[model samples]
Target chain A: MQPDPRPFDEPWQAQAFGLVVHLHERGLFSWTEWAGTLSNVIAAEQSDTPTNAEYYRCWLTALEQILAQKKIATPDLIDITTQAWHRAAHATPHGQPIMLESDPKRIEVK
Target chain B: MHDHPHDHDNNLDPMTARVRALETILTDKGLVDPKAIDAIVDTYETKIGPRNGAKVIAKAWTNPDYADWLAKDATAAIADLGFTGRQGEHMQAVFNTPDQHNVVVCTLCSCYPWSVLGLPPVWYKSPPYRSRVVLEPRAVLAEFGLTLPETTKIRVWDSTAEVRYLVIPMRPEGTENMDESALVDLVTRDAMIGTGLPQVAS
Candidate 1:
């Protein structure tokens, strides 16, 4: 559960791992605790069978929640990260058109 | 991180202004604390860096057996290379074949195989990528300079729960004799995303 110091060997991996370490050092969930919680969440979501994507999403959601709960990241930081994500999305030339405004209230119920 | 005077300028872009507005609302609602922003930035800079992905790709290109192992059991395979846990413990790599083009997206949110590919790129987590990739994969891939034949089946992999996917694009033609390091150089971040294939420089 303690984030393996060697989990990431590449520079990028180390950098990413460093972010988590920073969060933990800042009083966010310890690496072990975070890994345990994430594993448990993934396990609970699994049925007799589970898809890879489902498992991926579960872990991601858990990571996001843990960060949010500890206040390790501000909404602004999340926004900036997500915005970068948006730019990558746009970089891809071919993909289905996705409607950003999904809330029923945001759409006129004609 | 260097200080940005431009960030403090009052004439904010529409997106920045909207973000500021949202921040104010969230702050007023006691949803987000102010100190958290600094912590977040610190984490991104000092903790989760981009080197993770680079390493995975480098290894994959260098070691065919390792690449095959990664395609089969990305988590354990990566761990064998001493890259496990943290953001990459649970991972998968989908192969992009001649007849089938694979693309990855996180529809609900920006779910990524961070352990292997490092952190998800900023755009991979964006609404446009998530919403559009599933619905319009060909158009998206096209933007990335990938034009698949109509007969080529486009399989969009959605990274959701504990399993995240990285694309293993077919090594380009005419680079059979290249050494691993040379091969690694051809695997770009975009190629791993399935937007482009690795091409040996002329």
Candidate 2:
């Protein structure tokens, strides 16, 4: 039998899926390489949080590790962005779209 | 002066944190163009939605032959409308009748068909939903503002990474004259997921 069709339950899950494909297309990492890293992450989680319901969490962790290992993003930069999303999500309305708000205190290199 | 509307929930925001982190890094190094990312997200966000599934459901409603085709071969019938890929490689359509009500859940993981119904909502992926829905489907449906009669049988279809289920809600009453397009307008994401019923003109 074929795999069940509906697999993702959240918008973020789809976005994360797309992001992985986009990164791969940009030559960041091969799916084969990703498979190994993801397996390790999943295996680690199984040992740690065996009942973890967050499957996408594993995917995100693997992606982060690959980016850091490739020197594409530093840990500090990632932290800043993560914090920014928290702030943005915090500020946005319940039904409104979650968008990153430009931090006036920080300068954009662009 | 006040732009803050959403409460800052400091507890357990790891998913948002991880995704934002990746987006930042990819955009910073020029490895990913933000516009491209937005375009992809937009396709799922705006261009695609429950309307696709609604159209399918509406077709099934209007045409008995199409409904049979959907029941016998959902993946192909869905693909007939060009909605196929990724998480949507396979599909199972569960019809809702007066005697039985069907709800979909993924206890192991959130497996949803993106090609037809687009992305799943946050609540659908919540741990409470993943665990509770299977244990007490009627209760879960109640929480979603869906109350079923005591005599009605509730069946919960557990979706896996291999196959996803789309709940074909019983068409609402008072819309017998509505065309497929109008019917599409009544089909909502929640209804497709079996969390809620299709819209009924009051």
Candidate 3:
């Protein structure tokens, strides 16, 4: 389903925003063009109610198009990212405790 | 556009329905080109994946001084390996200790450290994981079959701005003497996500 819109408003939201900006600045897509497309997609989805996956797919699609248009990254990059996305969706086992694998030689900073 | 039985409003399963609806809109609007998406995914898989991160992990395991350098400046350290851009240019590694287990979640959107870990998992970008992981990290970890010790302090890292984070999991027990490749085997995808510990084959 639709993600809680709250997180998208946080300061941390800028990370993704900045990523979009970087891609745009790199000539992938103009800010106006990207924003117009994204806003239109979001608005359309909002009219009918959207799922989380649907929204993400939309976002990823936008990213992919922009990257392709700019030729910032080759088609291969998109394939790899999508494959990882699919593999993780299916292969990530449920209900397991996760541990961080530290570099043994690295000192832990408090 | 075309009326599909699985429209967002009509679907019972919110997740599936939403994805379908969004896909329809994206396609209809020409916002997302599938061929392009596939291409981007392919690039990351072939050119930069966990192997790059593994190299960093391996070096840290074998070289004490290098590990020290990595902990201090993961970005520059990773750059030394010729892996830079997209996500890894500005990197930070959070170490997981016996008393402290660290996990990372973007919280906002899927702001992953692609430079090191390559592209993020689909779940990482999913609303369920992004929304819930920060709010209920322990429960999320439980889903991954990762249980922390009661005494262990749980720290959730939020990747923000220019800095991206990679979880440095503790070396599994009985693998102190093992070589790098053996150690890499223990460093699973979960370890990067801070959900599961790396296991060494006894």
Candidate 4:
């Protein structure tokens, strides 16, 4: 079967893509290290067979796991940040860039 | 075209939320500097993207030998101008002629020549474009507001592997007297993607 050649549907995917490359370039992790870690995570999650979107989800998961393992971040911190973004995004009006609100409650609807 | 997996949820996609969260976490922890990331992103978005490609196209317009070089070995020709890296390591330049029109799409993934084109636009990666362009090139081009002549045969190049394709749009007519800099100004990123044409002086 041929692989799907779809572009990222959202800006975040591109951002994630950039982040991964940037991190690797900065020597945070070697490509071989990333490949091994990512493949293992994908294998464990049965993401061995994943759609284009799911593939990036696997990339994120591996990234998170590696960062946590390396003590670069705590899983709890990531979760907290993720929920905050969700809330901010939900409160923001349509057709606006989803700017992160330092205090989620302070975001004006307008 | 396949319907994207998450359309009904009008909220920012979960991935976006997660990435933002990650950014925040990384920044707070001092593991990654947001400013540095922004600099890299800014460079690609502004300094490096299609402007680089425009210079190549413009040079090709003025220099026949250079055009021949690009046609024969895009990687080498582009590298000659210092536009070679990453997604563009393996490159191919396709030319458009009166009888032939070229458009590029990567049906499986968004593998663009970032060294030359920077980031792929959101629409390029959307399901409709990824799956439909190869099958219905005319319709997709039409939707982009590019109405080509019926006699112009459309050739859709599916960038299925390592070799990325860049469209060398035909130089607009009546620009015969224009210099390379003016011609470079006329070449927009969309034109290089074949969704738009070079600026026609009015």
TM of each candidate vs. truth: 0.53, 0.65, 0.58, 0.64
The two-chain DockQ for each candidate, comma-separated, is: 0.03, 0.19, 0.03, 0.18
lDDT of each: 0.58, 0.74, 0.59, 0.75
Candidate 3 interface RMSD, angstroms, 1 decimal: 15.4
Chain A only: TM-score of every candidate?
0.42, 0.75, 0.44, 0.80
User: What does DockQ come to for candidate 2?
Assistant: 0.19
Candidate 4 residue A102 Cα shift, in angstroms, is: 13
TM-score of chain B of 4: 0.80
Model 4 per-residue lDDT tens digits across residues A1-110: 11112345556765676677678767788655776676566555632234546666767998998898998878888877777777767766654566677336545543
Tens digit of lDDT per residue, candidate 2, span B1-202?
5467654433226675667667776776678886777677667656666778998999998999999999999999988988885432479999999999998886654567777777676666556787788899988899999999999999999876667899998988888999988888888888989999998767
The per-residue C-alpha lDDT of model 1 at residue A92 equals 33
Indicate which candidate wins on DockQ: 2
- Runs in model 2 deviating more than 4 A are A1-17, A21-59, A65-110, B1-36
Number of clashing residue pairs, candidate 1: 46
Span of ten consecutive residues with least summed lDDT in model 3 chain A? A98-107
lDDT value for candidate 1?
0.58
TM-score top scorer: 2
lDDT of 1 by residue, A4-108 (tens): 122222332332333344455555566456666665665456443433344444544565667567665566666664453344334333333322232233245
Candidate 2 lDDT, A24-59, residue by residue in tens: 667677645765676667556633223223667777
Which candidate ranks first by lDDT, i.e. highest?
A: 4
